[model samples]
Target: MTTSRGGDGQSSVEVGTFIKTPSAHIVEILAVAGLDFAVLDAEHAPFDFGTLDAMLIAGKAAGLPLFVRVPDFQPSTLLRSLDLGAAGVLVPHVDTPEDARNVVARCRYKAGVRGYSGGSRSSGYGEKGMLAAVADAESVQIMCQIESIEAVDNTRAIAATQGVDGIFVGRADLALSMGLADSQHPDVLKATERAIAAGVSQGKRIGVVASSLEERKRYSDLGATWFLHGSDQSLLKQAARALVRA
Candidate 1:
């Protein structure tokens, strides 16, 4: 796990939070809520790289692991995200060996030539311990999204790609790719399970975004150690309901 800036920068285990939708205050909210890590969703959400940096700053202020889920398999985007100081990066649609390598390289520094700016949130905004920070960026957390049949089929090879830290199953998108309207179908469940199992055997941490605590438990039982429990919108709806009940 990457050590955050402050606020009990003292924890050991890694807890990752996903930010799929947008809100300027999301980073501050989740950070104060005690999340070990938080991700900005650039894939499906409307967040630009600049906004991502801002969110990272907010999360870091609270000592939360700051990460960004880049839009696609583009190395430039991934490189930009890493340079901005994402504690880690979640690359979506990792369906091939090349895609996996692309992301892995983005995390790398000198050996890979990712552009650098010393004074940024990523390198403690200065030269202080920048080399160590670069090393951490290379080996830190790299989560690949399993969201299609291609990824499901290429699971073993994808995991074998050196430097990948974990897997996050995108059930909804995978279902859509498989021509299913939703993730409730048994077929999608089987595919998701297969991916999770493959990840476990390969010694990679497995994860998914569960819609509820029950769903979280179910996936946890299936050996997913990393869980991005739900979306910003879902949390809001649940909180609103609770407030109404209260």
Candidate 2:
């Protein structure tokens, strides 16, 4: 298979369904369970910098690339996640070109103007040159969430942004964007399928946030190569209902 390098031109690795959760130990456990990458949910989950750092350390120790899903579009949040040693940062609700551009900036050092600290998991905790490590890792993976009509309309431009390595689609918010309280119509699936088509055509890795594995497969045929498999907090509940139902 051909290796697809990120903006940094480093090893282009394939990641499986990365579930969100607050525990670093669980992150490590999942890595051992055979996941290429794992993301710490800093966006929707209750977690602090200290906890995030520990997760990063655990993920790295387990030889898994760690990503952070930040809560918002704040550049500071994006930079902090990278500086703390996250392999990439996922920003949610990216609707405009400016939003895409600004989020991408957080992946750089000098030009990115990120606040740098060498003694972090990214630099091996002071064992490496902090600035260089960050610059390299900054370009690792910048996943921008596209979950609205606004984002869907600007989908092409967002994927074409300089620092973006992949596109993540949040269907629930997207459904709302289309003026539906929740998507039960084929129209939502059509919109998502279109987004995936755009992503594949642009050579960008397309990802989806599925409520379940079966739901994700619906889009897998549409060229979705990545998935957010399960969340740490909800995996059992999901499995119980989906796989172990009575």
For model 1, state the Cα shift of residue 187 in Å: 0.3
Candidate with best lDDT: 1
lDDT of 1 by residue, 63-124 (tens): 77777888875768877787776777888899987788777876777566566667766676
Reference-based lDDT, each prediction: 0.77, 0.75
Q: Write candidate 2's Cα lDDT for 1-246 as tens digits.
A: 123556965434445555456676787678887876767887777788888878887877888777788888676787678777777777899998889888877667756756667776566667778656755665568888889888888888889888788788888889988987766568887888777787777778788866666776676667676777657657757767887565
RMSD, each candidate, Å?
4.3, 4.1
Score candidate 2 by TM-score against the native.
0.85
lDDT of 1: 0.77
TM-score of each: 0.87, 0.85
Per-residue lDDT of 235 in model 2? 70
Could you tell me the C-alpha RMSD of candidate 1 in Å?
4.3
